[model samples]
Target: MKIRCIAIDDEPWALTLIEKYVKQLPQLELVATFEDAIAGSEFLRKYPVDLLFLDINMPDMNGITLASSLINKPFIVFTTAYKKFAYEGFELEAIDYLLKPFDLDRFQKAVDKVEKAMLAAKLSQKSNDASIFVWSEHQQVKVILSEIMFIESRKDYTCFHLYNKPKLLTLLPLKKTEELLPSQEFVRVHRSYIVPVKEIRKIASRKVVLQSGEELPIGRLYADNVSALVKL
Candidate 1:
């Protein structure tokens, strides 16, 4: 898999040099380049990438601060002239540190490290697919999709009703939780409810009856979604 990347530096020449080095590596694909650290941080939040080449010292926001603020952080490679920040970079478990004026050989070494790290992460993610993990009660809770009967949304938090198990509550938005399940398996009948399509036993004009005899209201906004489910 090609590693999608973005480079951020205050200096125009620094950005150009990283762009050139990224082109030389076939395994890397440069998505965008930014001269401002804050702009780069905003882009990363909107779009997901596999790697980042960041300069340590920049105006507005520094690289380390930006990296720490990311919700879903990617692998980071620190590129700057200062060697004093080397210790701080390693503390964040950065992929590699490249001093300024480095040659092609040094750049290749950094890319090689990213390649190996990405491969390992891919394998680990595959192993984690057996159960989805969400934070609750100050710890991560593993949830099996098949065991989930239905979901009830209470604004910021969601309640998960599982078969023969206590309800699990997590601080996840209803819309965000919907994106985690297979589209065909989970159907949204209301703005605040999501039920497993397989667990639905009956559907009325304004209510959905599940196998457990639990009834949930069908919101007007999602009426069309329930109609489509009936056709299935």
Candidate 2:
């Protein structure tokens, strides 16, 4: 997992320390550097900065206030001279607070936080994004890729019942989606319904009922493949 980070510190030595530490980690990429928090805010608006090495006691605004201003705040690890504000930093949901004159081991702890946060986000995206892209009517539309309960042939076009989306009329045939998607997950239940095996609620002779309680007529031609799926 790669984490794009920005360093915001007023002191030149502090910035140098951050740069050296960031270079040591393969997973971290130093996206931007700022001498002050104000300039850093402008840089962030233009580019997406994932993790921040922020300084608390800047000349004008405090790092805590600046961090709060971001709508989608990055993972913050406060690097400051003041040790008194450590508890307050935690209140901001900072990944870690690194007091000035901290060692390389302490810096690695902050980098670890970024790695963990990124892994969680990737897992969430995989679980939530069940949609797939398709070209339709000279435009592109995303159909719930997993919600494709079944597909049916309509002569030239294949109607994919991705439920709640006006039946996705694709130029490709029923076998196209099946071939593209995992074959182990989908089986041709009937000449019409190429049902996702996971969505099949129950199977009866001649027909298989889907989770939505819709009965799809199973064909004799596809019976052997359907029977193999049920055994697995």
lDDT of 2 at 226: 78
Query: Model 1, which residues run further than 4 Å from truth?
Result: 129-232
For residues 103-199, write the lDDT of model 1, one tens digit per residue: 8899999999988888877755664464578888999999988788899998679999999999999998888889987787789989899998878
Evaluated with lDDT, which candidate comes out highest?
A: 1
Q: What is the lDDT, from 0 to 100, of the residue 218 in candidate 2? A: 84
Report model 1's TM-score to 2 decimal places: 0.55
lDDT score of residue 35 within candidate 2: 89
For residue 209, give model 2's deviation from the true position in Å.
33
How does each model score on TM-score? 0.55, 0.55
What is the Å distance of residue 147 in model 2 from its true position?
13
Give the TM-score (vs. native) of candidate 2.
Answer: 0.55
